[model samples]
Target: MSATFTEVLPARKSSKHSAIQWRPVTDDTHVAGVLTIHTDRASVAYTVSEFPTDWPGRGFLLAKETAGTDPESERYSVFCAAAGPWGDTCDCKGFTYKATCKHVDAVRALVGNAWL
Candidate 1:
């Protein structure tokens, strides 16, 4: 006996914009892999991976006052610090005043490969 799976593709025309669809080619075989999709808003979607389940979604904000090489660059410094303890809530020192500060937005922009 084998297992099978199917994934529907999104409706985008551009090769860069088109969604990916995955399915098992065999009836008696099992396949496991990871799928990641990036969009205009820097959206990240992952499948069958420890990276997704372990870390999940997170945002970062760069410290404007601090001076250095700007580890995350200027565009993605929106979320330089953890919102809360382990990012549970947006209560970090960087977000004391504003709820959705520039740092948070920058963090959202730097998800996935951008972090690496």
Candidate 2:
């Protein structure tokens, strides 16, 4: 599935927006593959098997950051998929100060509006 969201601020000179592109992963390691925030950023790989076993009505997402141009540069962060007041969480560097990461944002954007 593929989707794009653009937040354009007329007052601002810069274009503020993000895009999410995901697809079902057939590999044994992951369930879905994705990229968020900007295409230049790393892709996020998701897996249902790793979801918190005790969390009800919730699943897990593992966002992996990879540089296609540089194969060795790769990293991943864990995230929780939940409903209601509780939102997604991630261990990515941005989460330390923002409490969320691009992975969570991408998932939210995917779930907040539609499906693939």
Candidate 3:
């Protein structure tokens, strides 16, 4: 049940990073997936937006990095659960803050590795 959702993939990204599986939480508004990103440097925090009440739809700007960087920046993107395909439009504050965010990047890497 929960264990399956929390399963982590093998390490990637220069042998310093790995993406753990997503954990599902039930909400009256939207279902959510929380993924943990592990790096040799530090632990990364991530969040996903509310999944729609309907099926077969994409969740966009739902993913975000909650912490694990200087001043605790944020990042956002999209992920496919049982809904449909995986896609993302990064809205991380880093662009405006003039910094790089690994949250969206991590999600992109995980999905690219077929972890979705």
Task: Give the winner by lDDT.
Answer: 3
Top-scoring candidate (TM-score): 2
C-alpha lDDT score of every prediction, in listed order: 0.30, 0.45, 0.48
TM-score of each: 0.24, 0.52, 0.48
Q: Mind giving the per-residue lDDT tens digits that candidate 1 earns over 31-83?
A: 12222333333433222211222343443322222232323432222223334
Q: Tell me how far the alpha carbon of residue 72 in candidate 3 is from the true structure, in angstroms, after superposition.
A: 4.4
Local accuracy of candidate 3 as per-residue lDDT tens digits, 49-87: 543434453343443355564444354544333422233
Clashing pairs for predicted structure model 2, backbone only: none
Error of 3 at 2 (Å): 2.8
TM-score of 1: 0.24
lDDT of 1 at 70: 27
